[model samples]
Target: MPRSQAATIRESLSAQIDSGLLPLGSKLPSERELSELFSTTRITIKDALLALEAEGRIYREDRRGWFVSPPRLIYNPQYRSHFHDMVTRQQRQVETRVLSASTVLATPALSQELSLGPLAQLLQIRRTRSIDGRVVMYVEHHLKPEFFPGILQQDLSQSLTLIYQQRYDIRYGRSRFDIFPSAARGEVAQALTLAEGSPILLVFRINYDQHGRIIDCDHEYWRHDAIRITVDSHVAAGE
Candidate 1:
C-alpha cells in the first residue's frame, strides 16, 4: 500500500531540511500554505509538522512558525572559559541579559552552599544567555557580599571572573561542578520555552579561592540539544 498523505508530506519536508534547501534557522511555510501546496487537508499538514518537531528536525516558537533546528554548540568542561568567549570562538553570536540583581537574606540551603552564616546577606543574580537569537541557558549566581563589597554597583552583566580579579584581587583556584540530566519544571521550563517536564541539563557549580573558601555558587539549566560536552583523557608516561 502507498504511504499516507501525512507521511509523504513529512518525508518530503524532511528531505528538504536535510538537503539544506530549507536552511537551518529558516522558518517553514505557514500551515495553510503547506496544506495548499501539498493538496492535502489541514489535519494532514499539522501531523506532518508535529512529526518533524518530535524528531528534532524542527522547532516552534510562540508567534513564530516552525524553524529548522540549528547545530548544537561544542562545550569542553575542563576549559575555564567565559560564555561570551566560548560562543564567539565557535563563530556564533551570544547575548547575556541580566534578568535581576539584588541582595537577599540567605536561606538555610543558600547559606550552607555558599559557606555563609545563617540569615547573612548575599548577592543574588539571575541571567539568561542566548546564542544566535535562541535562548539556551538560564543561570542564578549567589555570592557572599562581604567578599566583594559594593559589588551590586558594578555591571553584573560582565564576566564575573573578571570582576573577582580586578575588584577584589580574588582568583579562581579550584572548582566543583555537578552536571546531570533533569526534567525542566516550573520557571526553568517556561524560560526555555518548553513544556513542563522537558528534558534539560542541570548544573551546580562552586568556585573557590586558594584557601578553599567559596567564592561563589551557581545553578545553570540548559536546553538539552543546545550543548555538546566533551572530555579528554591523557596517560602519564610513568604510568
Candidate 2:
C-alpha cells in the first residue's frame, strides 16, 4: 500500500536525522515551513513531527521548536566531581535553573536526617537541570541555614561546591548516596518532559563538611534514559 502524506514526511525526516543531516541538538524547521516544504497541511506536518518526538528522535522545549535529542550523559558514582565539571568532561553542556528558593520548617523526617533541634529552619532550593538544552533532572536540596548565612541571597544556579569554598571556606567532604529506580510523577515528571509514572532514577545524597557535619541533603529525580550510572569496584584480597 502507498504511504500517507504524513507518513512520507515522517520517513523523510527520520531518514535525515538517522543520516546525520539533522544533527543532534539542531532545531527542526517551523511547522509552517515544514508544511510548505512537504506541500502538506499544518495538521499533517504536526502529526509527522509528533511521531518523531514520540520515537525519542526529537524533543520540544517551552516556546522553542523541537530539537534533535542529544546523547545520554554518563555518571560515575565512584568519582567525587562537581556536576558542572563532570558534565563538561563528558563534552556536554549543562545548565541549572533554580525553580524555587525558600526557608521552611523542617519536617520530622528532615529534622532527623539533618540532626537538627526542634523548630529548625531549612533553606530549600529546588532546581531543574538540563543537559544539552534538554531538561533531564529535577533536584531538591535542603540545607541548614545556620551554616551559610545569606545563602538564599546569592545565585543558586552556579556550582554549590564553588560557592561553599569561596564564601565560607568550607568544602564538601565524605558523602553518602542512595540510588534506585522509581517512577517519576508530579512536578518531576513535568520538568523532565515525561509522562506521570514514567520510570526514573531517584538519588538521595547527604553531603558533609570536612568536620563530618551534615551540610545538606539532596533528592534528585532523573529521566532514566538521560543518564547511565557506573561505579568502579576495587578488587578484594580473596577475589
* Cα-based TM-score, every candidate: 0.78, 0.71
Q: Candidate 2's residue-wise lDDT over 1-239, tens digit each?
A: 99988889999999998899999778898999999998889999988987776566776654567777777788875456589999999998999999999999999988998899999999999999988877889999998888889989999999887888899988887778899988867888778777666567898988899899999999989866577787656622222
lDDT of each: 0.83, 0.84
lDDT of 1 at 53: 70
Which candidate number maximizes TM-score?
1
Q: Tens digit of lDDT per residue, candidate 1, span 157-220? A: 8888788888999887767889998877887877778766756788888888767788788899
Index of the highest-lDDT prediction: 2
Model 1 residue 228 CA deviation in Å: 0.9
